[model samples]
Target: MTYSPATQDQLLAIRVNAGIADLAASERFSAAEPDMVEAIVEGIGAFAAGEWAPLNRVGDLEGAKLENGVVRLPGGFAEAYADYVAQGWNAIAGPAEFGGQGLPFTLACNVLENLGTANMAFSLLPMLSVGAIEALEHHGSEAQKAAYLPKLVSGEWSGTMNLTEPQAGSDLGALRTAATPIESGEHAGKYRIAGQKIFITFGEHDLAENIIHLVLARLPDAPEGSRGISLFLVPKYHVNDDGSLGPKNDVRCVSLEHKLGINASPTCVMSYGDNGECIGELVGAENRGLMAMFTMMNNARINVGNQGVQIGERATQAALAYARERVQSARAGSPDKTPVAIIEHPDVRRMLLRMKALTEGARALLYYTAGQVDRGTLGDEAADRRGDVLVPLIKAWGTDVGVEVASLGVQVHGGMGFIEETGAAQHYRDVRIAPIYEGTNGIQAADLVMRKLGLENGAVFAALMADIARDATSDEPTLAALANDCAAVGEWMRDTASLDDRLAGSVPFCTMSAVAVAGWQLLRQLRAVESGEAPGLAAAKRASVRFFLDRLVAEAAGLKASAMAGAEPLYALTSEQLAG
Candidate 1:
């Protein structure tokens, strides 16, 4: 399906119910006065079809070429990027007071997913910029905002987060980047940032006039480890007061690394202050770099989750296309004279269903989380309370599906999926980083367990469970069946304890939580579809949810078993035992 248009009657139903409509409705949700949803929809659709969609294959096939110390993107990127900017897409969810469209993130999430689905590599620049925007907006001085926000929002320039160094993989505590105060003269109060950042996405690029780097640096008297780190806005090229560009900053893109996927996006190794004059203005208070970066990290993590959803959707579309055209052996009951489309085979259908179910389910989960974020942003105090509880859960659970669902896509494509030419392999390659980057899935799990689990002293989770139970008690057999599964899984999680147990089984726990939460989201989506008796959409929602709970919900048993298997046994085992 090209674009699923929500009928006017359905829109009216949303107005009547006055409930949530997922993150993509952030603009609709936030606008105090009603406006045309079609405008946002048409705007995003045009960007997707005209700009982003046409670039995916080109990016994958052409990739990025490393020449001399710079990475050159495919030929059409700059033009497509210009188109995106011209359409005002970069500022779609930006602050209106600062030249943005003044829309909420949920609306941005919708646009972002389509971009990712079309071209993830190209889409990543804006994703990182979003994080940079959040950091600067929340923590940057008013002067800094005035200097940078307009350019960044207007897409005249791009932004990136710079935290990882050579030694700092997942562990930020090991960061060796340092920022020493300037001794004297022209640049007073500023610091010289001297460090090498690895795996810096969009660290250096030609798409924008300048790249604003949000660098984490340590002051001269700063302590060791993460505590001493501080945030700084170090631009690649200094900006003149008239909004003109000036001298290049001390920072430079030393080189770009060859990667398995997202080749269209430049991942660079950058060295700041090699000339002993890389100027950086500190953000917020001293020793608050990590705190500031976390906002970007948190936002990017959720966006990455959406990236996963987008990839899964793309793969599903590709696989469906392949299955329809590729002929294979006939099924047992079919006539033996001629071959049939692979989709006609039971196994192929099963795989397609699995992919469809997983992709749809993931979309629902991520979209619901975005809805929660919007609710927190625009909804009153009572609604904000619940949104607060869902953030980490959204981040953790959403990313897990990206990896899992993409893998399912690969499986459906069979051996052809392994080859790069088919494009299916690229989805798998790109998605591999989702779980690892933006704070590894492990860290997401740890956050969910430590922070989210205790939100409102766990009353929030408890209330959600109670609501599930209430729904299950209804005369509707389908919901009653769902309630049974929900109760079983909830009990398992509630009864479990110990970080060892949690860690040992964290991946599975993440998946299970994703399934349950997504099921809940599907129910809401079904309600949205059903409110106006949009049967096809409602049927699709029900089928997707049923497929998940029936086939995937049982995986909770495995998760529970693993969660209960504390690290004690593994720790107690001798090295010899591990060797065996």
Candidate 2:
């Protein structure tokens, strides 16, 4: 549903008064561009409310079917996709020369949030296409762009990134896919890709003309591991120089997976070059596929984080609506009285509040990160640096919180929530995938530890802490303490003599960072209340921040202890001890 202008304005004002709006003004997030934000909000909101919502239940129930090697989407999906392409939704953020709107990624993030909330299964196809388009645009030759960009941008066809092989999984070094140079006339300088890629989304869908598959393979003579990898654009149908469809390529979908969620989207196991002639063109320099594909994956990671926030928001809305209407037990003292709505109960209120806090906090964090990316687009180096630091934090932390928040939504509905009819159960099921995909949360923690902690020699993180410390300055003693705690931890990281030892504390450091950032935003939100917006708004912000610090920040201590424990103890658990 389209949220009222009043509501949007209110949220914006609250964010603004709290200094959150300053995030965009700080040139950290470019979505602050009024036109871009409005266009994204409007287009995504309309598409979400109209096409996607109506099909969500159908997609879940009917799902997708694979027969005779082709997967058929649920009824109404094709029509929906056609409408999506007709509206140029797929082109909103692509390069302008390719017939796209050429909007910044911040707006795209907003649109993706809506898509995920409305129906993630349907949205993934376009999302994946966007990723592939980005890879091609950045590294493809002029001829390649002219041939493929128009169709991709117009959504006449779609795209896929094939990286996860059955044996490879997360270890690109173990990838066994091969790319041998062709020895023929028309396909001279081309390669023949031969490998099986697993878990390829939209591998055999019929919504588009010809799927552009970005395959990662190693040339026969190339050195092993990630260094020898190369990216190839292998379309389902070969394209003539005139951009007309030619012979069918040999990429085939072997089968589809039965997944826990997003079932409407096919997860196919694709076999390339079974016929020994899947003609492929290299995207960038050979032996640099991993680097080329990484740009797309990083973008996807942030988008996945946004999906988590969207699902959480949807769950919260559903739970709040249900609680306000469903009657339950009356107050204990009110003897012989009729039962009241669960919303009237203190415990229920607490659960709802907890859900709201988690969802809102996650949303703020995600949106702030989106805004940062937008700022980066505007050529602000500091904003770009900050965005880099926040990306992993937002992705890992936001997705983790999405699962928790969705579960809490289920909890609010009690036994009814356990049933499929409640819909809250679906949100829980859907969001569980977020933390697992786009690299697991633990992986993110390790990245934060080994990689991000060392960024700019810790200056970027220190600046973030300084911002939190500034916001935490207040008359409230608890807030003041929180500010001090944030500042202390930041200083500790900055002053530590052992960089590796400090880096060892990345997990704890990230936890503290979450606390610091959330607290910073909440205080900003609290100021919105002070500015005479809604009294409840500011009060809720204060209470939530207080609850977060009081209930959650203590984990920082435990994390810090673990961080200080060093690598040896953490890795010391043997197989024999583990068996016991």
Candidate 3:
């Protein structure tokens, strides 16, 4: 089923919730006029529904295939991708200096949301490209940027991040990939990279002329663990001095991964320098690859959060439509006793409202995070730190919402949701990968509890809570109170808890924090709806915010107990006993 766009909701999120007015008033984002923003949102919706949505089911069924070491996508993917490149979608938010429109990053976030909702697997290509673009724009040498940024920004060449090895997943220090400097020759300032990187998304695709890989590897004399790592610019095909395509590099896709979802996007086993000729240029300083890769990974993390919004929106659309059409038992105590549409049923209504509310809340949170990201990019240090704190919340909680909403969507469809043909299952399967990848939701929560809560001696976390409180209307104090409670948990984690305690309660704290933040965002949208600022979406937006507050937010307040629960109870059970 093609995605029915959530343009009105997205526009409301951008204008009301995300506070685009402040962004547009700034000299940096002067081009973000209301008309342009609306046009961009509408355009993305139309494009996704028309060009991208049709490929969603096909990609799931056909999947990307490995043929003679080359990855081939389902039919129409290449053409659709070419259309994506040609239309300048990739360049819309890129730097103006490198053939880009230089729009606010939030617009790009919205574009991805629509595209991904239409076709999540197909969307992975550009999604990965955007991350690579962000990484190169920040750390690549001027020469590297000059040679790579233009094409990458233009989407003529795709990009991949290579951080995972068979032996090293989250533990970067365990990585054995080695990069040895080639001291002399035509490629003198470069290094010979030799390693095997697995689970590389879009690692091998023919849609783009070249694939630029930002690899994290250790130099021969580098220190052990994450610190010794450095970022490298490796291309599938070498680029000439004049920017022409040259010979193929030693990097090759050994095989494509068989996966549970996102089959349209190639998850490849990449082998570099098996022939001992893989050459790469360093993107940043030695022993600082972690910092550089984090730049890319951070970008991906926020977008991965957006993936949650995408799948949730898609699932909601499918379930809502099914509920409206499927005939079911008569409403209780009806005089005529005739069958009614399932949408008339109370339980189904609750499920549908919950689905839409969570989807909208997740969308609002993603946009809020994106706005903070733009503010951070424009030099608001506090907003930047706030964005950092929001990332883990959105990534973990947002994906959790996606899974929950998708499951509910399945329930709305009854038994039909389980069968793949109905299309509800695709959303469930597609979104399942989001929480697993981009550092599993557990890792994101640990980052939230252990690393982020302590930023600026707790001031960043405090400021975030304060923002939520400020947004809370007197009529709706639940969100603010919840934020305060979540803030208390944050303080406890930073000041009182041991490392084990922090890690153990991390996910719960993250959940409570996300509920507060998302509730505040929905409140802002609710105010806009009530005030008639977004007249067209008034009723729907109002209901969504209300259901979120009355149901989701009210129920989440109980998480504080779990959030502050110490680690002792977790370790009380032996590993084997727990496993059994």
Candidate 4:
């Protein structure tokens, strides 16, 4: 089955409901028109389905090769990337001053979903660059911005985030990378960095002229732990005073990781200053690298969530197509006794609905989070807070759902899914990394319960719950019951006394919160349907909402119960007993 992008009607509803239409009218996106936005989305979707989708399986089969010191992508990847750059898709949500289209970030989310659905591994090359562009735009020096933004924004060069080391995965405090102050020469006051960073995505690729690495290292006299770390702009090739590239910097891709999925995107073990000449300029202030890196990390977290949505959407489409065409057992009530499509089976229908509901729900939450990002940039402080609060939930829940839906997609395919030829297993493998990387889902849950809960002394979370409660109400009894369940769970979380109790239940709480938000968004979409917009798609939307409320929302009570269970039972088991 050919991959299909979201329908124009679906995109339009998201635009309207998320307030992106008004956002497009702002001076930042003043050049944008409704027709133009529609055209851009359609064009990109077409390019993705036609050019990129065909390469997904090929990418999986070919993977990426480390030829000598350089990384080479699978067939068609470089060409597709060039086409993507030439079409100006890279600049969709980039800074306008740097030659970007400066459209709303929400629109960028739509573009990412389409691209990611077509081919996830291919999509990752540009995805990491988006985070790099964000970091440079927010924290890079004026000179650094002038030197890098245009090319990175134009997709002539790609980017990477180098935070992981062999010894320091999630613990930034344990990083041993060193950055010593350099003296004399054109690069004085800059630091010469020497370190090894592992799991660096798109660290070295032939598709771009140069790779810009946002690296984290520590100064010689810096204090211990994460507090002393600093962010640096380290380019693969040195930039001259006149904006032209100079000789290659002292960085090399020592090796590439053999992964279960996303094989076309090279995960490299990068060595910096091995011969002692890798120069890097400090970004932001000294001992404040974590703060600066957060800019990129936050951007990446959202995009990661979109990855989940994309994979889920692709899996669902593939499963539905197969179910429709693959005839199976005879229907229970068939007088003719002829076999029917598997979709006719009640259990099969239930599985498809589960896939549909989860995919749609994830898209709603992700798009809503993207809209908040745009609002935070163009609107007030509250919008910024809302964006901050939703990032972890979106990243964790969206990805978890992505994995779940993709697994269901495989289940729908049955024997064929396990065989790999049907392509269902690839979706499952590709998405498994999402919940593990960009801050594991466990870490995200911890962030939600521990850090985000205290935002504005809890007013922010309270406001979010209030919004969910308000939108969750409906004349339909099922909807009303779901809303009450969500509200009751929210109250329990708010009133929970033990921090350990909250920690133990953090994952479930995050899941419960995401389902409620998704339920609320779908409810709003249903209201739009009642107003006679996109009547053709309304039935599917109604069914998805119904399935979400009946099946997924029903889990909220159990999640709440688990959340209230505290950490005592969790610790009751001895370490040896648990291991056994």
**Using TM-score as the measure, which candidate wins?**
3
User: Residue by residue across 1-580, what tens digits does model 1's lDDT show?
Assistant: 2322223322332332223344334554455234544466556656776667777777877777667655678877889888888888888778777899766666577677778877788889999988888889889999899999998888888999998888778788788888888778877888888989999898887788889999988888788888998999999888887878889899888887888778888889999988988999999888999999988887787789888777777777778887898887776696575888888888878777777777776676665566556666665554555555455555666656666667766776788878777778878888777777788778877665566555676666556545655654453344444445444444445466665665665565555555666665555555666675555566665676567656765554345556556678777868998888
Ten contiguous residues with the weakest lDDT in model 1: 1-10
Q: Write the per-residue lDDT of candidate 4 for residues 1-580, one digit (tens) a residue.
A: 5688876544744564566677766877665577877787788899899989999998899999999898998878889889999999999989988988788877777778789999998888888898899998998889889899999999999999999799988998989999999888888999999999999999999999889999999999899999999998899999888878899999999999999999988999999999999999999999999998999999899989988889998999999999999998898888868999999999999999998988888888887888788878886679789889889988999999899999999999989989888999999999899999989998998898888877887778778777766655545444455445644554566576577877888898888877777777776777777787667878888898889878788775467677667789998999999999
Give a tens-digit lDDT track for model 2, residues 1-580.
Answer: 2221123522442244223344446433434465555555766677776888778777877788888877899888999899889987888778888998776565566667777778878888888888888889988999999999999988898999899888877788888888999877889999989999998889888889899999999998888788989999999999987889998898899998888878788989999989898889999998999999987887787887877777777787888888998998886677757899898888888778777676666666666676666666667688777777777777787887788888988999999999988788878877788887767766776676556655788677667766765656554444445545645555565565255555566666666566556555655655666787556556666676566655555554455555554456544788788788
Angstrom error of the Cα, residue 468, model 2: value is: 1.7
Best-to-worst ranking by TM-score: 3, 4, 1, 2
TM-score of candidate 1 to 2 decimals: 0.90
Tell me which of candidates 1 and 3 scores higher on TM-score: 3
Lowest summed lDDT across 10 adjacent residues in model 3 is found at 467-476
Best of the two (1, 3) by lDDT = 3
Off by over 4 Å in 3: none
- Compared with the true structure, model 2 gives a TM-score of 0.89
Task: Estimate the lDDT of model 2.
Answer: 0.75
Q: Quick one: best lDDT, which candidate?
A: 3
Question: After superposition, which runs of candidate 2 have C-alpha atoms over 4 Å from their true positions?
Answer: 1-36, 332-337, 475-508, 525-558, 567-573
Order the candidate numbers by lDDT, best to worst: 3, 4, 2, 1
Stretches of candidate 1 off by over 4 Å are 1-35, 335-337, 379-389, 472-496, 533-539
Per-prediction tally of clashes? 0, 6, 1, 0
